[model samples]
Target chain A: MAFDAFQKRKERQLLWLLLPALVPLLILTIYPALYAVYLSMTNEALTGVAAAKPRFVGAANYLRLFSDGRFWNSLFVTFVFVVGSAIIGQFVLGFISAMALRRKIVGAPVFGAAILLPNAAPEVVAGFMWISMLAGGDHATLSKILVFFGLPYVDWLQTFPLFMVVMVNTWRGIGTAMILLTAGLAAVPAEVYEAARMDGANPRQMFMRITLPLMAPTIFLYMLISTVSTISVFGLVYALTRGGPGNKTEVISVYIYNQSFAAFQIGYGAAGAVVALVVSLALGIAYVRSLKVEV
Target chain B: MAGISEKRSGAYTLLAYVTLIVISIFCVLPFVWMALASIDSNVQLFLKWPDSVTFDHYTKVFAEENGVRWFANSLFTVLSATFIVMVVAGLGGYALSRSKAWWKQPFLYAILLIRVLPSTALLVPLYKILLTANNGIGTVLRPLVGEHYRFVMQLFGFIDGYLGLIIVLATGQLPLALWIMKVFFDGVPKDYEEAAILDGATLVQRIRRVLIPLALPGLAAAGLFAFMSAWGDFLLPLILLSSPELQTLPIGLFRAFLRVNEIDYGLLAALATIYLIPAVIAFSFARRFLVQTFSGGVKG
Candidate 1:
């Protein structure tokens, strides 16, 4: 059992090495996640009587959350934000950008860097810049451009708050989508296109028959990752409109923030948090399973 | 490879060029406004050619505002967090790569699942946990530190302290760094370690001599990602630190922005640009690693 002893010692040493990383993640992430589920069933608060004498009220918070119109609004807004930006807006633009970049076009790198520059911006900074661009004035950056092109100036954000939010989110993330889709594109062998060309396939046919089918897996993974991340988006929504112009752009994260901190309803916020947690965890499990099977 | 190019009509090629240019403009316009406004003597919310360029806004951020303190707080905490991730993940990654224990697979999966847990969802209970820890630290330090209690707690207390922020930020970044390192070490040749073992190198000596040297590239990737992510984080600082002195750049910029009536675009832009530069620099270096990082963690 000398070899077994040696193996045992090695495993023990390795486990010790992982302890520092493990301890904090457990204390901060995992423990709190479980705590959130527990917190949801209670009537916790940051102030007043509930803060001092918090008591468990099983499913009361969830029942309230389910019936709350604002809660439903936040969920609906989140759905639109994810689908509009990550799913449709970023995907379509990113796909086009990626395809165009594949043409070995001039200034491809410049174009790529230009697209990615926004991704480098912090959420507050991005929101700040967009506020300028979409401000309600004749001289706003976007409006000035519109005026130059014989279009009228309108407050982009106020006029279409949800759409503007979606657009800005799309602008910020197009680079990621482009990067991921570019990777996916590269995976499709050039020889397949060559063969398709020989068979009298046009660009459209090649894309539909060859590219789309082949890129499905990468596209799926990209969608899942982006969707989950998008669901968690708070800073951008907060910066642009603190869920304002009515409940127009109140994504779930922002709603949770407004509820927990602004409204001082910690227990109710935990209910929302738990729902988000469950949804994200389910998607994450699917992502992990896909990674295992594919990679 | 060039078959598609030949098949693509001249008109289509022209279309591609146009598409790239337009998209690039859309992407870069906001940044253009921010950069120009930051320096313009008379700034506007709208994009315009600067009438006269001045560095006054930048200087004012440091001199008139709490920019220096905020920048320093952000830099210190984020850099410390990045360093912590690099070290912790380096060791843990090596272990995960080498270990045949029953927990290894579960641990890897756990970290990935952790990545998916939205930070907002965790924020509520995380606040509570930090509060409890902050109280415990207060109890231990209150009598001991006496008059220096405030200053001491600023560094050590969990709720609003440097130590708490650094550790929490580091912990937030650990899953990815660990995943990166584990995958990185899996690719590293085991012969070096085996050779070091044959040379009668003890475990510590082996790690110091072999693993650390070999893990540098992986550690750099881990650290850079950690820096970029932590630098961009808004929620952590916004939630955890309540004191003005403890406010990081994002919070600082955000609060400055909230002064609606007298909102100084020039000063805010300057602060944002200053805040953004390091992240952009880190991101530029981290660019090549992106494909690898996404296509399953540096696996060739």
Candidate 2:
């Protein structure tokens, strides 16, 4: 009876403890999310009668979104961005860097610091910094370097907007990917490697047989994070291209922003936002399930 | 065979060193270019090396443009948000960590769910809510404050205000902070708290005297992250704050680029360089904690 009373007291204290964090989330996150669903169903605008009245249109926004070529294009762009930056570019380069750091090569600290440095800059600041480098014409940083190499000065962002954004995001994200992968690497036992070496296992064989299997969970976790985060990446890309040189680089986040703010179509933007949220949630669940299986 | 294998290994090591150096240069060269460009005038930007470096652009940014105001606004918003996140997360985390409540896991999952959702998903509705709430507050205060109602309205109109942005930023950051702090609190041994309990310390007393000092590193890490997120944020400020004077550094720099018909590369670079300094300094100071937190996160 005494223990039960103490437990009840503890629960009450815990509820009080949780209140501060929970209130903001309830007001800001939960309320907004439910509100988004309502907003998505209305013909809402920042101006006009739609702004004031906002009559429920019920699935009309979703219908329009389904047919919108630009919406499809944004999805495709986001897919390419996530795949290019997170999966291929950052993952490959980050893994290589992690492996190299583990080898303890000369100037490793300097190399590590250099890799980590880009992340220190704000996303938009990094975007602006890159704009100076990747700016068009003979005077831009990349162009000048190209000129020295006896090559034509390509207007990089204008010509390859999607690719340029991917490259820059990969540059920014590589540090994070490297850190996560390094942690995974550390968790692998030295004894396993030693055992493989005793059996005269080649480096390739050992990595394929041991490292790949052990690192699967961590790799998936990184993918889950990077993919979702990359999908949400707006500031850097927005600051760099504003989803421009046409809608060529307009990822979902940018598309949502444009629809809501620039076009003043709040309902349409909320529809896109909902889709993006669903996609992220799906990816997160798949990853969690895979992680559970691995465990 | 052994000699040949050793030579091959030596060659691989050399190759690895070369690769590392090349990659480092690839990463660092942009910042070097930015530094050089920022110090040079528009015309000198194209030159391999400028005839003379100047701080004229920096002077122009501060004096001509309202760089100082934007900087101050950013500092105020980020600091306030970080402070709120730390306090709320610290209290909540300690409770969640120590309590054996049946609902703890469900509550944690809910927080994680909210965290994973793209914050952009919330932005549209949040903007609406802020607008409606501001208007509602304005209506309520008008009758109460009489002639000073306009002044009160401005305070309530959070859409273009500091308070609104801080709330939104803190909300977005809270889940991560709470999760990190909970992990840190869980790692703290129960001995100290138990002793305090035996000594007849109240919950607040135990928390103040025992829990906080032990979780200082975690708090610092969480605070640093919250600060960085708030500082680097573009979309929140872009959507929430509308006034020219109220704009943060990112918006100010972006507008600076947009204002000129022809982009002034040197000036833009200088503004960007200045904008980068606080983040770089914060990152350098908190880098150890940041890395430790991430590694711990992965392990957990």
Candidate 3:
């Protein structure tokens, strides 16, 4: 009876302890999310009459969203951004960096530090830095480099806004992918490689047969985390392009921001937000179920 | 492993070095330009060797602009948010690690799911909620303080105030910090707490005396991450603070860039360099904890 009483008391204490975190989350994250759904169904505006008296329009905003070409363009841009940066660019470059670092090479730490530096850069700084690197017609860094090699200067951002955005996003994330994949690489036992070598397997064959299969779980985790994060990337792309040169670089987050604030269409933006939220939540659920996380 | 030919191995090692050098250059090139531009007297958009290295641009940021205010604002809000995250996550994480209640598992899953919900999606409604709270607080404060209303509201109001930004930033970071501290506390044996309890120590006493000392590393990890993330945040400050007095470094740098007619490359780079320093310092310190946190995040 006493033990039961002690256990009960402890739990009550814990509930009190949890209240500080719980309250803000309830008001800010949970409430706002639910409110987003409610707000999406209404003809809400940031200012003017709709702000004063929001009216429920049911599926009207969503119908409008389904037909919107810019909305479709943003989705396509986001898909390309996630896949191009997180899946392809960062992964390949990071994996190569990781692999090279494992070879008992000289100056490995310097290489590692140099690569990780970009991850530490704030999005705004990274965007501003890239503008200097890309925007200065004849005086841009890339143009200067091209001139040194006697090649024509290409107006990078204006000519290929989406690609430049992807590359910059890729640059920011390569460090994260490298660090995670490095941990994954370390976990694959040296004994496996030794056994493969005994069978006269080349490095390529050994990696395909041994490393790739062994690192599947880590790779999957990296993919899920990176994809979700890359989708959420805003300040970098926003500061870089502002979804412009004709909305060519508009990812979903920027799209939502532009629709809501720039266009003053809160209800319309919320509908797009709902779509993003659902997509992310679905992926998150899959991640949880797949990992069957220990917590 | 010795079954491999030595000649082939040499080539591969050389290839590895070449790859590393190239990738490292690609990664660090932009930063190099930013640094050089900050010091270059004749700085332009492109990378170039300085004809005469100068400190004038950096001084211009402080003497001519609001560099000090921007830096202080960024530091103050981010630090306050980090502190709140540490304290809240510390207590809540202990509860999570030790408790076997039914709510534990559901709560855990909810926070993990919360991690994936992008902040942009919630911005509109979040704005609405803050607006309502701001009005409520304004109503309550306007009559009480009379003439000092605006000043007090700037400090305490929910919409364009210090308190609102600090609380919201901390909350956005809570899920990860909670996970971090929970995982950390799980590894900590409960014997010290048990002993403290047997000595008739109250919960608060036990936490202050026993748990805090043991949870320092966990707290450091949580705090570092919270600081880095909150420091780097742009959207929250952008939407939250409209007043020039409240501008953070990111906004200040952004605004400096937005002066289309009078663009000063040197000063902008200096501002960026100043902004970049703290993040780099924090990141370097946080480096050792990265592998553990990322793997712990998923494995937990």
Question: Which candidate ranks first by lDDT, i.e. highest?
Answer: 3
Model 1 chain A poorest 10 in a row by lDDT:
A286-295
Candidate 1 C-alpha lDDT tens digits along B223-253: 9899999999999999999889899999999
The prediction achieving the highest DockQ against the true structure is: 3
Q: List the residue pairs that clash in candidate 2.
A: none
**Candidate structures ordered by TM-score, highest first:** 3, 1, 2
Q: TM-scores for chain A, candidates in order?
A: 0.98, 0.96, 0.98
State iRMS for model 3.
1.9
**After superposition on all CA atoms, what RMSD does each candidate show versus the true structure?**
2.1, 2.4, 1.4
Q: Give me the runs in candidate 2 sitting further than 4 Å from their true place.
A: A289-295, B42-47, B143-156, B291-300
TM-score for each predicted model, relative to the true structure: 0.98, 0.95, 0.98
Q: How many pairs collide in each candidate, listed in order?
A: 0, 0, 0
How would you class the docking of model 1?
medium
**What TM-score describes the B chain of model 1?**
0.96
Q: Residue-wise lDDT of candidate 3 within B1-300, one digit each (tens)?
A: 454488788889999999999989989999999999999999978888898999999999999999999999999999999999999999999989999999999999998888888899999999999999999999999999999998999899888899899999999999889999999999999999999988999988999999999999999999998899999999999999988998899999999899999999999999999999999999999888888777545311
TM-score of the second chain, each candidate in turn, equals 0.96, 0.91, 0.97
Higher-lDDT candidate among 1 and 3? 3
Fill in the DockQ of model 3.
0.72
lDDT of 2 by residue, B76-110 (tens): 88899999999999999888888788778777766
Candidate 1: tens digits of C-alpha lDDT, residues A215-285: 99988988888888899988988999988889999999999999999999999999999999999999989
DockQ of each: 0.68, 0.58, 0.72
